[model samples]
Target: MGAPDFEFRADLLDQSNEIVLVLDPDTGEIVYGNATAMDVLGYDEEDLLGTSITTVTGFDDVESWAEHLPQDEDADHRGENEFVRSDGERIPVEASVSRTTRDGEDYIVVLVRDITERKERESELRRQKERFEQLFETAGTIMVVLDEEGFIERINDRGSKRLGYERGELVGEHWFETVVPDDVEPEVQSIFEGITTGERGGVDGHTNYVETKDGTRRFVQWHNTPIHEGDEVVGILSSGIDITERKRNEDELERYESFVKSAKDVILSIDDDGFFSYVSPASNSVLGYDPDDLRGTSALDYVHPEEKSEAESGLRSTVDGDGDDVTREFRFQRSDGTWIWVEAICTGCRGGGSDDVGIAILRDITERKEYERELAHQRDALEVLNEVVRHDIRNQLQLVTAYAGMLEGDLEGENQEYAATIRESGQNAIEVTRTARDLAATMIADERVASISLRHAVESPLEQVRSAYSDAVFVVDGAIPDVAVAADEMLESVFRNLLQNAVQHNDKAVPRVEISATVDDVATVHVADNGPGVREDMKDDVFGAGETGLKSDSTGLGLYLVNTLVDRYGGTVHVRDNDPDGAIFDIELPLAE
Candidate 1:
C-alpha cells in the first residue's frame, strides 16, 4: 500500500466522526472499514469487508451512484443519498464518492455524514415560510415591504389589486417615484424619507395619495413598523387603508359647514338615544338659541308635545336602518314662548360603522304657514258663498219650471204657443243655473280628470243641446274612432256649451251645425256652425271671458268655460272660419297609448 504515507495516523481514520470506507472499484466489495463505520452500521470489521454498498441504502442500483463519482483529481465528490444501518434502519446522509489508486490497484473512498436532523430542520423552515406567505397574500388591508432605499421589495395581494397592477409588476419599483402623482411627489418625498430613516419616528395616520396604473389616484393612510435585524432597521413593513371616500366625505362636510354657517337652515345630528350630538352654527341666528345649548339634550325636547311621539318613532327606525330617510313638519318651541312651524328632512346616520342615529336639515317656514292659514280662511268664505248661490238660485229656477207646467195644462191654441214659450224660457233658466254652478265648480275644485273617449264627450253634449234648441240640427260625422282625453264627469257639459253658443248666436231660422272627429297620434274634434261667423281679429281672443262674435246676442261665458276646462285637462281648443261662411272649433286631445 506504498507505506500509506499519510500526514495523520492510520488509526485516526477509525476515530473520524463520519463513516469512512475503502472498497474495490470493479466489485461490490468493501476493502477496508473504519471503527466508527462498524459501530454505526452494527457490523464487525470482518463483516464489512466485501459487503456490497447497496445494502446500506433503499436503492437497488449501486452502479448508478458510482457513475456520479469524480473523474478528475482536482474535483472533490459531493452529493446526498440514503443508507441502511446494521439494524436495517434507513438514514439520510450527505456523501462524497470518488475513485482512487493504492498499490497500483483501483479503489473507491466514500465519506458519509448523517443529514436526518438537518432535513427535519429544513422541512420545518419550509412549512413556516409557506404559512407566512399565505397570510401575506390573504390580508385584506394593503400591505407592503419596503427595502432600506424606499423601494418596493414585496407587496401583498391587496396592495397590488388596489394599485391596479399585476402581482409582480410593482415589485422592485421605487415607491415614491412611481406611486405618487407628479404634482405631489416633491412635497411627499422628504416625508417618506423621514419615515424610512426613522426621523419621523412614527407613520400611523400619515395620509398620502397614490397614483394608480390607470392614472387615477387614491387617498391612502398608513401605519408602519420598522423591520429590524438585531438593532438596526433594514426595511419597513407598512399596512394601509384606502380612505378616498372618507376624505371626500370630510371635504364635503367642510363645504357643508361653510355653507350652512351662512345659511338660514340648520343641520343637526342625534345619537342613538335621541340626544343631540352636533348642531350647526346657524342655530343661534335661526332659532334664537345657541348650538351648544342643544347638544347633550334630547332632540325632541323642543318639539311640540303633539309631534314628539312621531319624531321619536322616526328616530328609532333610522337607528335600526329599517327604512328610508324620514321627513316631517312639526311645531318647534321658540325662545319667545311661542311655537313656530319648521320643515325637517331627517336621514338615518347609523349604519356601516356610523355612530349617529339621525341627521336632520331644518328650515323655517313661518311665513308660508301664516299664508296657508289665511288661504284656508278665505276658501271657507268662498265655499259658503258658492253653496248659498247654488241652493237658492236652483230652488228659485225650479219654482218657475213648476209654474210653467201649471200654465201648460190650463192653455189651448195660440194661447198654448204662449204657454209653450213660457215653459221653454223656464227650462232654459234652469239649464243656465246648472251651467253657472258647473263653471263655479271648475274654478273652485280640482278637475276630476281621467281618460275618456273624445268622440263620446262630443255626442253627449249634442244630445243635451239638441233638446234645448229644437229649431237647430246637430250632425256628428266622420269615422269617430276611439281616442282618449283627460276629462271628468263634467266633460259632456264642455261640449254642451259649445253647441248652445253656435245655435243661440245664429241669425238663421233653422241653424245647421256639424261636428266631426278624427283619430291619429292625437284626437281632433271639430264643431262647426252656420251662423254670422266670428270676426277674424277675435279668433284667438274668443277663448277669453266675455269674448263674443259681432252678431252674438249674449254673454261669451259659455266659450270661456269650454276653453278653461279643455286647457286644464291638457287639451287644446282653437277656432277657424268654417267652409261656406261659418265658425269651426277644433278640439285636440292627447291620444292614449
Candidate 2:
C-alpha cells in the first residue's frame, strides 16, 4: 500500500482520535497509517511508509506480531504493552487488533490508546501496598491480620513473640482457639464474626485478656479495623499492647482505697504548699467534715488559734523532709466550730514527677485531755482544803481542850465532871480534824491506789488506837498476814479508823477488840469489837458521810474515809455482827502483783 492509493480513505481515518494502522499480516509491514498515527508516534508519512509494524509497537519481530493478531476473521483481541516513541521514550498503551480482508487482500487493523495516567495510578497503588506490608511486619506492638473466617492470615514478629511462639508458628491458626483465653473465647469470636459481616463496627482500645503459650493470661488493649474490598468487609486488622503490669498496679491501688474508706481515723494528704490534696472517706466520721470540703483548702485553717503555729511548723517539717515524720498534738476546729484535741502523725511521701506530699493520720484525744484537766483541778482544790484543816481548825480545838482542862482542875463535884467532859470532847474534835485532813490529802492524790504491805499498815494504826484507849482490851487473834494489798498511803488510815470505831463506840465498861487477817487470793482484815452490835437495817448506811454511830454531833469522816479509800482501791468493806455481841468490820483488798 502506498500513500497515494490511500488518499480517498485518509479523510475518514484521520477523523478518528485513535492511532489507526493497517498492516499486512504475512509480511509484518505497515500498509497504511492514519494522521493520528503520524502525530502520536512523532513520525512523517515518508518515515512510516513501508516501515515494519515492529518498529513502533512493542513486538519482537514479524512472527510475534502475527501471533497476537486474530486467527479467525472478524474476531478482535485486546492487550496492553508499551509503545516506543520517536524520541525513544516508552508510554504504556492498549491495543485492539482484528483481521479483515479488504479487496480480497488479508490485512490487520489496529487501534492504539494512551494509558499513561491509568498506569501511574496502578503504580501508586502497588507502592502503597508495599508500604503497608512493611509497616505491618515491623510494628513495635502486636499486629495481626485475620481473614473473614477468623483465621490468622498474618501475624507480625511482635505478635508472635508476645504470645510466646516462634515466627510463623501461629499463621493459618484459628485466632480465638489459639490465643484468646477460654473464658473469653466465645465473646471474642462473636465480635469477630460481627466485624467481618459489617454488623458491628471496628473496635478501638477494647480491653481483654489473651492466653500465652505458657497458659498464663496477659491483659491486652486492642485497636481493630475492618479490611474492606470495595463495599464488602473481607477481614480485620488488629493492633494491641500488653497492659498486664498496669492492670496489676490498678488492682493494688483499689485495695488501698478500700482500706482508707473503712479506717476509723482520719487519713489525709497535703501537698508541698500545705494545701489539702486528698482526704479519705473517714474524714466525715472523725473530723465532722466531708472529703470534698477539705480538698484544695489550706489544712491549717482548721487548727485552733492557740495551736496553729505548732501545727504549721510540724506540717512544714514533714513536707520539706526536714523531719520526714513527726507526731504532735493540736486542737483542731471541727465543722461545728468546736475545738477538739487531736494527735496527728504526719509523714512525708513522694510520687513520680510530682511535688512532695505529706500524709497525716489524725486520732481524736479530746476525752483524755479533759480527764487530765479535771485531775489537775482536783489537786489544787485539795491543797487549799488541807491547809485550812491542818492549821486553823486543829489549833482552835487545841485551845478549847486546854481551857477545859484548867477549869476542871479548879472546879468540884458535878461542875468539875462537866469540865472534864468538855475537855474530852475538845480532844475528840482535834482527832476528827486530823482524820479530815488525811482524807482530803488522799482524795487529791494522782494515784490513790498502790501496793502497800498489809501488816505494816495494820500495825501502826493498831498501836495508836491501843494508846488512845488504854481502858479497852485489844487482842490480836492471829499473826497479821505478810502480804501486799492494793491500797495507797491511805491504807493506814483505813485500819486506824476501824480500830478507833471499835473502842470508841463500845457499850461495855472495858472494851474488848480483836484484829486478825486471813490471806487467800485477796487480803481480808477483820476488826471485831465487843461493843453494842450494829442493827442489821443500818449496816449499809453506817459508812455514810455524817452517820456517826450513837453520836449525832460527831463528824463521821473516819468510816466514810475508809469506805471511799477501799472503794477506790477496788476493794469491799462491810459491817457484820461479831461472833459474840459486837460488830465486825471486814476489809477485803486485792493482792497487788
Which candidate has the top score in TM-score?
2
Q: How well is each residue in 322-368 modelled by candidate 1, as lDDT tens digits? A: 65988777888877768888888788766667678778888898889
TM-score of 2: 0.58
Instruction: Give me the displacement of residue 2 in model 1, in angstroms.
Output: 44
TM-score of each: 0.56, 0.58
Clashes (candidate 1): 2
Give the Cα error of residue 294 in candidate 2, in Å: 4.3
lDDT of 1: 0.79
Clash numbers, per candidate: 2, 0
lDDT measured at residue 398 in model 1 versus the true structure, 0 to 100: 76
Q: Estimate, for each residue in 274-303, the C-alpha lDDT of model 2 and write its tens digit.
A: 988888887787789999999999989989
The global C-alpha lDDT for each of the candidates, from Candidate 1 onward, is 0.79, 0.87
Candidate 2 Cα deviation (angstroms), residue 471: 28
